[model samples]
Structure formats: structure tokens, C-alpha cells
Target: MSKTQQLSKIGNFFRAFGSAVAVAEATRLGHQPVASDLRALGIDPVQFKSIYRR
Candidate 1:
């Protein structure tokens, strides 16, 4: 697959995983992670923050 497609697949996983992580953290904090913010996966394709959180 092309680099773009590869990134997208990775992005999808990151998006889903990140959403889950955010939701978990938010739940602990008494709030929910907004789904729209993570939608950046479509435009930005992988969030470095998600792939390499520190």
C-alpha cells in the first residue's frame, strides 16, 4: 500500500485507541473526551501525540 494508505490505517487505530484512552481518563475526571477533536485523523492522518505519547 501507498504511504498515505498506510498512515491512514495507523491513524484509524490511533484514533480509536486514543478515543478510548481519552474516554477513560475523562471518565476518571468526570468528563468525556469529545469525539470531534479526534476526527483530526482524517485531516492530519496520525497524531504524533498518540503514536508517541510522552
Candidate 2:
């Protein structure tokens, strides 16, 4: 697969996983772990925070 396609697939996986995790945690704990949510979406909060801060 092309690099773009691979990246897109990864993104899709992250979105699906993140959503699932958010729902599960909301059901079990009554609160969402936002960092875990981002991680499920294949994102690192530390990395994102750094980039976003700029």
C-alpha cells in the first residue's frame, strides 16, 4: 500500500478504537480518560500537546 493509504488505515483504526474505549469507560467509570481516548486513536497526547502548543 502507499504511504497515504497506510496512514489512512491507521487513522481509521484509531478512531474506531478510541470511540469504543470512550464508550466503555463512560459506561464503567462515569468519566472518560481523554488521553486514553486519544491513544486509542493512535495518538500520543504528549506529542500532540507539544505540536498543538506551537
Candidate 3:
């Protein structure tokens, strides 16, 4: 793949991984939710929440 494509793939991987981790953490912290988990992962809660919701 071209450099840009490679970078895109990497970005996609991280995004998916982050979403999975956020889901797991949200399940673990019953009171909190995936948005909070995304925040913990250093992502903007609102934006990440929107992405994860998709």
C-alpha cells in the first residue's frame, strides 16, 4: 500500500481497538459508560462516543 493507505489502515486498526477496549472498560465499570472509557483512552469523549455509536 502507499504510505497514506498504510497510515489509514493503521488509524482504522487503532480506532477499532480503542472501541473494543472502551466497550470492555464500560462493561467493567458498571456505573460509567463507553464514552468515559474513550476519555480514559485519551480520546475526546463526545467525538469518540459518536464514532463508537456508529
Candidate 4:
């Protein structure tokens, strides 16, 4: 991969990782997670809540 493309991938990896960590921490603390962070991990916030309702 080109240097720029590799850098972009690295950045995306960290961004996604950060989002996952934020969501996990929020849920652990009994707080609402950010919808954008959930979406970053390919989760739909609405459907995710519905799963808990079942």
C-alpha cells in the first residue's frame, strides 16, 4: 500500500478502537453510549437497545 493509504488505515484503526473503548466504558458505567461511536463499530444504536428490551 502507498504510504498515505497505510497511514489512513492506521488512523481508522485507532478511531474505531477508540470508539469501541468509549462505548464499552460508557456501558460499564451505566451511562448511555454515543450513537456515533456505536455506529463506528457497525452497530445500530436503536436495534442495540431493542436487543436489551427482549
Q: State, as a TM-score between 0 and 1, how close model 3 is to the true structure.
A: 0.55
Which scores greater on lDDT, model 3 or model 4? 4
Model 2 ranges off by over 4 Å: 30-54
Instruction: Name the weakest run of 10 consecutive residues (lDDT summed) in model 2.
Output: 45-54
lDDT scores in order = 0.59, 0.66, 0.65, 0.90
Residue range 1-54, candidate 4, lDDT tens digits? 899999999999999999999999988887778999999999999887765521
RMSD of each: 10.9, 8.5, 7.2, 1.9
Kindly list the per-residue Cα lDDT of model 2 for residues 9-52, writing each as its tens digit.
99988878767767567546654347766676666757645542
- Residue 22 in candidate 4, Cα distance off native in Å: 0.2
Off by over 4 Å in 3: 31-54
Q: What TM-score goes with each of the models?
A: 0.49, 0.50, 0.55, 0.89
Residue 31 miss distance in model 4 (angstroms):
1.2
Best-fitting candidate, scored by lDDT: 4
Candidate 3 residue pairs in clash (backbone atoms < 3 Å): none
Report the C-alpha displacement of residue 53, candidate 3, in angstroms: 20
Worst 10 residues of 4 by lDDT: 45-54
Select the stronger candidate by lDDT from 1 and 4: 4
TM-score of 1: 0.49
Q: What tens-digit string does per-residue lDDT give for candidate 3 at 5-27?
A: 99999997887777777677775
Regions of candidate 4 where Cα sits further than 4 Å from its true position: none
